[model samples]
Target: QSSNVPKLGTCITCHGRDGIGTSPVFPNLAGQKSLYMVQQLELFRSGARKSEMMNVVAKSLTDAEIEALAAYYEGLDPGK
Candidate 1:
């Protein structure tokens, strides 16, 4: 992965270190299906999933970045 990707940093703020969200309002991304994570990220990027913060955050990600993020989160163990 490249050091230039920003979504990883942006994600940690709400989704926590590895996509285990800080609270109920923020859904846990860790252990989620990779394709599902990609879909939601795309939706947020395209404004289909209406979230002011996510819309802007997702918009900043490229397709490669999205895929990388999905894979990163999907690989996490939710139980941890």
Candidate 2:
């Protein structure tokens, strides 16, 4: 994983270290399916997804970073 929670630039702004979003507009990333996150992130990187914020963030991420982030988020306990 090239990226860690602390190393995350924009993600940590909305989705915190625990993957829980700080605002209602930001969807919770905790315990989400890794594959789903990977797919969505890939789409966001490729401009297939239409989130202005996500696109900018994903654009700077590598494949390994994306997988790492997805795994990290998926492992978080939403019930926490």
Candidate 3:
């Protein structure tokens, strides 16, 4: 799959290296529903959800990338 956005550990900056959010403000992406994740990303991209960081991040992501990211996070065990 192809992507227009730069792939450079962009998700790790805030969501943490393991997709478990370090802060309560950031939702734990680990083990989250893929559909829910995709929806939230789309919402951020479309301005439905107002977050400066997420809006910037989601705006650059392609649909396939979003799915891959969501799947990757969902596979992680948050309890670790």
Task: Report clash pairs, candidate 3.
Answer: none
What's model 1's overall lDDT?
0.86
Where in model 1 is the C-alpha error above 4 Å?
1-6
Candidate lDDT values, in order: 0.86, 0.85, 0.78
Residues 1-80, candidate 3: write the lDDT tens digits.
21332342788778876777878887777778878988998998898999999999999888888887777777777888
The residue pairs in collision within model 2 are none
- Winner of 2 and 3 under lDDT: 2
- lDDT score for residue 28 of model 1: 92
> Once model 3 is optimally superposed onto the true structure by TM-score, how far is the C-alpha of residue 52 displaced, in angstroms?
0.7
- Give TM-scores for every candidate, taking all chains together and pairing residue i with residue i: 0.88, 0.88, 0.84
Instruction: Put down candidate 1 lDDT per residue, 35-56, tens digits, no spaces.
Output: 9999999999999999998999
Task: List the candidates ranked by lDDT, beginning with the highest.
Answer: 1, 2, 3
Model 3 CA RMSD to the hidden true structure, in angstroms: 3.7
State each candidate's clash count: 0, 0, 0
